[model samples]
Target: MTTPETFADLQIHPAVLQAVTDVGYETPSPIQAATIPALMAGSDVVGLAQTGTGKTAAFAIPILSRIDTDNRQTQALVLAPTRELALQVAEAFSRYGAHLKVNVLPIYGGSSYVPQLAGLKRGAQVVVGTPGRVIDHLDKGSLDLSHLDYLVLDEADEMLQMGFAEDVERILADTPEYKQVALFSATMPPAIKKITAKYLHDPVEVTVKSKTQTAENITQRYFQVSYPRKMDALTRLLEVEEGDAMIVFVRTKQATEEVAEKLRARGFAAAAINGDIPQAVRERTISQLKDGTIDILVATDVAARGLDVERISHVVNFDIPHDPESYVHRIGRTGRAGRSGTALLFVTPRERHLLASIERVTRQKLVEGQLPSVEDVNAQRVEKFRDSITDALNAPGFDTFRQLVESYERDNDVPMADIAAALAVLSRDGAEFLMTEPPPEKKRERPDRPERERPARKVRDDLATYRIAVGKRHKVLPGAIVGAIANEGGLHRSDFGHIDIKVDHSLVELPARLPKEAWKKLENTRIQGILIDLKLERGGRSKSDKFDKGDKSERSGKFKPSGGKPFRPKQ
Candidate 1:
């Protein structure tokens, strides 16, 4: 078998070839080389490749080649798990199909429907959207897929993991049975295999092996800290680490903004990029990163897809990802183009299992790193301060400033060293040049109470119980609540405790020392389209009094329970 060296070797459409050339894609990735030909041959494809493996082009190229420009009906429909991925895939289609007269539209939630409806009315040849949004358009009859010839599921495993299996199935069912189906995923779990078995017709399976493990040319390390101390640990690390550019990956969009805000408050040049940011602003953020205006980018996984910045010298996993593949993808943003990169993962003590899983997947043992001590931070700060002074001494127009300083010293009868010291202090603007000493670790004494006699009514010392409005009546399951809270609060599964589901509400126990920001996020978050209405339980309140008799007016008007009735526990 002859391996194709270039995209043109696969006999791509002349227009597509031109677009690919314009985009500077000199050679196709292994997945693209293998899958594009198979797809262009009109065969169903199952592509197994990781996130950064160019899977979008693998399907987009062939889809663009086969699209009928004269027929404006939707010919290809791409389903992605998140709006970010959907927009990215749509952009790839538009970019790859630029030379060809093809219309591509991206329809996703969190955006107005007017443009999507108008695009569908204008007859886009390719439509990309999330499963739920796609279903909405289909039900409204705004998106006509009766003539759809191609269906592609990008990140199929993520879609399933996010509980989109039913939506995906329904969307697939709506498509023409004879239409070619292509499913691309990082991993082929049993669920994805089942989807392929049911929907694909003798699909051509193409697996692109990742050539490099995450550990290759990357210095991987982890810091074990309690949840409350993660922010302090991260800030300390950032102070001492050497990196021209860095990316900090958080789990939630809210965390991205919160972390970015905190970093900025500490006088760091940081920006947050998440799904909520407009496409134009996101592009500008990336551009600023590449051009050195921004040194730190705090982002979520979905928002950082396809981000390739040569200057990114470090990747910080501010929050451990849900899966090992996502960890790989996050760190892969750095250590590119034969450059060495540093990846620091912040793992709470309870999240050690996830850390172990990542190590197992990367096939490298991560070195447990310590937080930079106060002394270390002070030394670095002093060194940088001296360097700044040295640079200023050599800069142009320094003589005039020096003359003014000398005149002041002579007039005030102050020593030259004192003036220099005063100027240095002024330069720092009264900010602490050194970190305060970390508090001594305190040993907890065990309670004298007998283990068997411990009060059942009392909450566990390590667990804090909270009440939520959604429960079985709202079709809320324990797993659903856990998933929502964990994702929203940027918490690990172990961070939660027993979940008691009542008729109209649920009680969940989370880590007692959860940060105030995380608690606020959990309170404001929603599950199953209803606000969680989460509140810390007070002592001596009857369950009925807490749920049924709660004042509805106290809650935010933005979110309400399904019915006008207040939440009530089962009798």
Candidate 2:
């Protein structure tokens, strides 16, 4: 694989070699150059490469080449640590095998099982699944791996941290002995090191180190915004960050398009780059970027390679790149040679762990950048607008424009101030650019229940109470109960009265003489996608049911019961 500079030098099928050329990859990265030959030789490999260094393709190409399409069995298995990473790796496989019509299935938690089971039934050759779900399928007799040819463990260290080690071993135990084993990780922790030592047979190791950024010319900085208002902070930063050109990186293609479209809509020239774009269009877009037709390029990791723009003055990760190596390559895009450049990274409350990783890699703490207010963007815009007007007034061609303005002033009898204000009006963005208002404050949450429960007001003396098995958090407005009764129970709205929502249950007023069939219908009806359950409400059952006391949920059904979680609907 290291014999020549191009991917064609590798001992791969001609079709795969041609596909690599079609994607415009002229040189192999370090990991690709080293690990690929060993894999193609049918030897096991454990690749130690950082994120964003073409690790996906390193194992992907070999797996695709070795898979036998005529054999209708699961020939390849790729296990990722997280669902997001699993989906991302499966997408890479699909994109690389677009001409091959290879069927790759990505199975993970969070999604339903029916579609996945269906894909498996259709004779998919490559099965990518999380460890826990993969183990579940193996136990269920659905995921047959007796015919597996290549087994890849991607991000092995992460899977162990997420507590998937037991499941990983169980799944690996079922693979055929002759299968080629490949493991890739950012770091070789003790656990993964042990697993590789036991399972791999004379595996060749390849490590690709990311070029350090502090050694380069880039100056890195970070700003800590509180949990609620990061969007406003990014907007304020973008206005001041503007220069000849820039590349803003987000986590996904949808985000790239969204942030880019918003920037363009706000009058800055911005465009997005991602893998979905056709090769011809992506090349043309990159060409336009170099020719000064585009001022800003918003992109994701895999799409922004081979970018060498002299005009790029800044790089913004609108969202933090997935790993520290990604962070280095992103900032490295700017600050070439001895040129000074700036990098602004955005992090959220939950992602502070990732920030810590970046600091460790760079060996320097990132200085926080101040969040700009609305006045900041307006001041910059007004300064530029005024400069533009001054330049036009001083131009050699100003005499003609001045004559036209003066002619209008004389003929229309308009005051000069009025004319100037009119001209400014046509240029202002809704005339509020100068009237700076701070971004809207997030809503302060009010306590859901009263500090002290009110004394039970008797709707019927010595009456029976029924539990609705739902609560305030379900958006169960009082009108829903009133209408459900009036429509289904053949009663007027006045037939029902006061309703109460407790920590996990609710109570509603109903006539004592309600019939059994109607009550059964009421109990079975699903209100807002939640099945209604009618039961006796006891004044002391809250204490008996351990309503806020234990880890056990009130309803433990087929899936893990989520008590009082917010409602999510299918799109």
Best by TM-score: 1
In order of appearance, the predictions have TM-scores of 0.78, 0.61
Per-candidate Cα lDDT values, in order, are: 0.78, 0.69
Judged by lDDT, which candidate is best?
A: 1
In candidate 2, the residue pairs with backbone N, CA or C atoms under 3 Å apart (3 or more residues apart, or in different chains) clash, namely none
Residue-wise C-alpha lDDT for candidate 1, range 7-118, written one tens digit per residue: 8898889999999999899889999889999998999999988876788999999999888999999999999876667777888898998899999999875456799999
What's the C-alpha lDDT at position 60 in model 2?
A: 87
How much is 336 displaced in model 1, in angstroms? 3.7
Alpha-carbon runs more than 4 Å astray in model 2: 1-9, 94-101, 109-122, 132-142, 214-219, 224-233, 250-313, 332-342, 346-356, 363-379, 387-413, 426-430, 435-571
